[model samples]
Target: MAQARRELAERLREGGSESAALEARVLMEAVAGERDPDPFGRLDPDATARLEAFAARRLSGEPVFRIIGEREFWGLPFALSKATLEPRPDSETLVEAALDCIGDRRQEPFSVLDLGTGTGCLLISVLSECRAATGLGVDLSPDACETAQHNAVVNSVSERVSFVQGSWTTALDRRFDLILSNPPYIPTAEIATLDVSVRDHDPMLALDGGADGLAPYRIFARTLPDVLAPQGIVVLEIGAGQEQDVIALMTQGGFAWRGSRRDLGGHPRALIFGYALK
Candidate 1:
């Protein structure tokens, strides 16, 4: 165990990362009896081989989340796959803004629609917050839909959330009291410049925003009017520089900007728009 830790530490140092040693330790413990018991008292050779494979993948530019098939968001563990984008902390602003807009608990349950749902993080977080809320998460990828379903189950909200495979609101036939999305808002041209963790490992559909990084918003603006119940709210996660453009599209679609929420880093990250009549 000591020898393996030392080797992993040296590998991490060469990779310019400090967390490698801790990860290796945890993996080693997991393989051994400390974290979880194995068939053998000591670490299983097969498990150690798997750990080496994961470490090699991580070293070769794969994200740790992808290698582990899970990510932590809102303090909950969410299962992830190549089909969906990894959950990011910045998107938490969507949950906060949604909670603020939805207000105190209601006697009647309200429905939420999540477009481009990836790993069901946003929808599941909102359902976790609003006890009276049921949500439907939509994604174009079938794999993403499965991943979202797995997340809903893991978060203990499967009964309150449904995952559907389709683009935007195409598969949604019911109206929702609130809609939220962390759609692809990065301009297509800028995708190549993203960090290797995102550019190489994350799903392209979750990152590419077409031309101006506003295509999804445009589609949402055009489609939301049909599915949003009267007086409903739409909360969207926007690119660092896309607040105004998203607001403009929402305005053109007859939705009015309620407010914008900044992320922990103070970048304008979430935009809340409500029906103009509201």
Candidate 2:
């Protein structure tokens, strides 16, 4: 099994996978159906065959997360569906920023709204931490909404979370204490330049952000303020180098700019702002 893992990693490395070793381990674990067991002892003929097939898919440029159909965000395992975007480490920046902004209100029944919610990762993860919170996740794609609902169930957050398929801020007419989103931000022209894992595997509707990658932000700036409660906080995942432009756009749309958080790569990834204090 170890030899198989190494062979798979080598093939991935040759294919330019940055985390070949890590992906190999994750894939093997899935095939092994065990956590950190003796890989050599864990292998059966059937498992070995599955590993080879998984390795072949990986070599062909399918992301390990997609092949495994799962991802980890904020220490929780989230299952991925074809309609949902994989929960990425960078998106965790938004979660951390939201948690920090809501530090003292963790036990309160603070309401949350997640826009363009794919996999419902943002809202569901937050609800997992904020035990008393209730959340609503919104997305235009029906399939994504269903997947997110399923994720909520698997995470045991269904009791506190609900999902709906509708345009941003249109399906509901209520105020929320917090709003979060990791909306599509890649520029239309730049979508073609993304890696195969994103350009081809990820849905174009989830990747394209109009001509300048600011279209969704523009929409947020226009619509979000109407549904935010007094002192309500807003956390958004921004594309790299989009800090000032996004801040300016939100400011024009009437949100008070608070600040932003940087990701591990030192990029301004999560922007934070809020309504005027009550």
Candidate 3:
């Protein structure tokens, strides 16, 4: 095991991986099907083959989570698919802000609607905390819906959640106490300029936000109010420098800006909103 780790780290280092050693350790454990595997143990032929393949994929710019087919968000495991975006730590800001907004209502039987749900991380995480809350996750990709459903089951929240393939809130007929979304916010042209890890690996449908990157926000502005309960709150993840634009769009839709939350990096990442009259 020590030999394999050293060799993989060396290869990844040569391939320009900044965190080669950590990647090596993670990949090794993944191949062994355990966390922190025995350092003295040797890999079987199958494990060795799998490690080599995984190494090559990593060298080709696939993210570690993509290779492993899962990622941890809000301390819960969520499976990923070709059609879904890998839930990032920045997105946790949305969950935190949403929960903060829900505050005293956390114990209530609130309903949550997560649009562009992807891996269902936001909805599932929220439901995990609000035991009495039920959620519906909506994604445009069938594969994403299936993957999210599986994640809900893995996290033991399947009974409280349902996944559907649809565009935004089109499939919904009822209002929700909370609505969350981390829609694609990258401008169409800027996508090509993103780092290879993101540009090459994440699904484009989960990244592109049309010409100005505010297309999804526009859709939300036009449709969100209809699905928000009288006292409902909406928390959305926005790209850098997008707070004002998104707030304006939501305001045009009759949503009043509540406030915003910053991610660990201190970027304005989560925007909160509620109906203007309420």
Candidate 4:
């Protein structure tokens, strides 16, 4: 195992991986089916082959989580599919903001709606933290909706959560106390310029944000009001430097910017909003 790690690390380093040693360790542990594998343990022939395949995929610009087919969000595991975006740590700001807004109401029968649900990470994570909360995750892709549903079950939140294939909030006939979304906020032109791991592995539907990259926010501004209950809160994950642009769009739709939360990088990544009239 030590020799295999050294060899994999060297190959990844030569392939331009910045965190070759760490990635090598993770990949090794994954193949060994444990978080803490015995460094002296021997890999079976099949495990060795799988490790090689995973390393090759990573070297080809696939994200480690993408190659593993799952990612941890808010400390919960979420399965990924071609139609779904891998749950990212940056997006966890939305969950934190949502839970903060739901504070005292956490134990109540809170209702949540996650737009562009993807792996249902946002809604599921919120539901997991707020034990009595129920949530609905909506996405345009049937495969994404299916994958999200499976993730909810895996997270033990299926009974409190549901997923649907639909556009934004159009299919909803009721209002929700909280709404969350990590929409595609990347400009169409910028998609090609993104890191190969993102441009090549993430679904275009989950990355392209139209010509200006704010199309989804525009739609949410115009439609979210109708689906949000009075005094309800909406938390959105925005790209770096998108705070004001998104705030302006939502403001035009009768929503007021409440505040913003920064990601680990200190970039304003989560925008909080509430009905202007309320």
Backbone clashes (count) for model 1 = 0
Candidate 2 C-alpha error for residue 177, in Å: 0.3
What is the lDDT for 67 in model 4? Answer: 82
User: Superposing all C-alpha atoms, what RMSD in Å does each candidate have to the true structure?
Assistant: 2.8, 1.5, 1.0, 1.0
Residue-wise lDDT of candidate 1 within 1-278, one digit each (tens)? Answer: 66776687678668866687776665556445365334244445886787688678778877666777777899888988888889888888888888888777543599989998989899998888777789899999999999899888888999988888888988577899989899998899999899898998899999999989999999988999999998788999999788888899999999988999999899999999888864
Write candidate 3's Cα lDDT for 1-278 as tens digits. 99999999999999999999999998998999999999999999999999999999999999988999989999999998899999999999999999899888888898999999999999999999999999999999999999999999999999999998899988678999999999999999999999898999899999999999999999999999789999899999999899999999999999999999999999999999999984
Every model's TM-score: 0.90, 0.96, 0.98, 0.98
> Which tens-of-lDDT digit does each residue in 1-278 have in candidate 2?
78878888898899888999999999988998876758557578898899989988888878898998989888988888878888889899998999999998899889999999989999999999999999999998999999999889989999988999998998578999999999999989998789888877887778888999999999999899889988799999999789999999998888878998999899999999886444
Once all C-alphas are superposed, what RMSD does model 3 give against the true structure?
1.0
In model 3, which range of ten residues has the least summed lDDT?
164-173
Better of 2 and 4 by lDDT: 4
Error of 3 at 277 (Å): 3.0
lDDT of 4 by residue, 1-278 (tens): 98898899999999999999988988988899988688888899999999999998988989888888888899998999999998888889888988888888889998999999999999999999889989999999999999999999999999998899999988689999999999998999999899999898889989989999999999998999899999899999999778999999999999989999999899999999999965
- In order, candidate lDDTs are 0.84, 0.89, 0.94, 0.92
Q: How accurate is candidate 3 locally (lDDT)?
A: 0.94
Q: Stretches of candidate 2 above 4 Å error?
A: 276-278
